[model samples]
Target: MNATHTPITAEAVTRVQAHYENVKKLGHWTSDRRFEVRARRGMAVLDLRSPQIPDGDIDVEVDLDHAMVKLLVPQDAHIDHWDLRYTGRGRVKDWTGENGEGRRIRVTGEIRHGEIRVHRGGVATLSAMFSREFVQDVRRARREGTEPTVADPARSS
Candidate 1:
């Protein structure tokens, strides 16, 4: 189980691209205030429930083409994706909408035949649990003979 995880600092511009491949950015990975995601005919998951996230609005610039991108955010997070330009059935599936409080996630960009799904609260936790990364972590823990980070309250060191 060789997983490549990128460390995103508070001042760095984190970018994740998935072209004809699946990309999962989960666990307790730190996140920057701004992100750039490009998904073309592939699947991408960006989990931002880490405590290292800045205390303010988060901006995510997406460029999607026949792809699916899922964002796992904090329960108190308020997502604002109205600024996204859609073409050919591209849309954002957020049931809770924007509640106007907590950390605001501003999404802006163009999508062509793609979708962006937002998971918050318990839904987000479930999404993180039922993932390939989690499976790898569990397997690694069993091999290393130690408690998996998945059992911890926070998925951090």
Candidate 2:
């Protein structure tokens, strides 16, 4: 673990599973998790429906091959898509990682004929991201060093 005091990666980093088929759901990641996923001809969804991350950033790498992945984070999540590489026609739709900032969501990955979609599917309205309250809350959380309100990032079920 890097002790740099950065909430984005302050504590330890956890690597999640790699999917090959079927439908896999990542319930909720409430911490600074280095979520690694590889989906081949399969589907994976980052569904934080009932629960929310609330704070901090998440590091992710998706090795997708002819697969479709949907990232349904909180409407307030700051998606900082740092690295993205694709081959043989890959596409990202409605992904706000390019022009978004809040609780950083650092996403990096490679794909081949795959699609990664990021959407605000939670309770937040379409205009919620631009609200003053949402901005203040995000700033406060970033300043206060908000920790995880859910389970440990390293514990995989």
Top candidate when judged by lDDT against the true structure:
1
Q: Name the Cα RMSD for model 2.
A: 11.0
Residues 85-109 of candidate 2 have per-residue lDDT tens digits of: 9889897766444444444566788
Q: lDDT for every model? A: 0.79, 0.57
Give TM-scores for every candidate, taking all chains together and pairing residue i with residue i. 0.81, 0.59
Cα lDDT of model 2 overall?
0.57
* Backbone collision tally, model 1: 0
Regions of candidate 2 where Cα sits further than 4 Å from its true position: 1-19, 26-32, 48-54, 95-100, 122-157
What TM-score would candidate 1 get against the native? Answer: 0.81
In model 2, how many backbone clashes occur?
A: 0
Deviation from native of the Cα of residue 145 in model 2, angstroms: 33
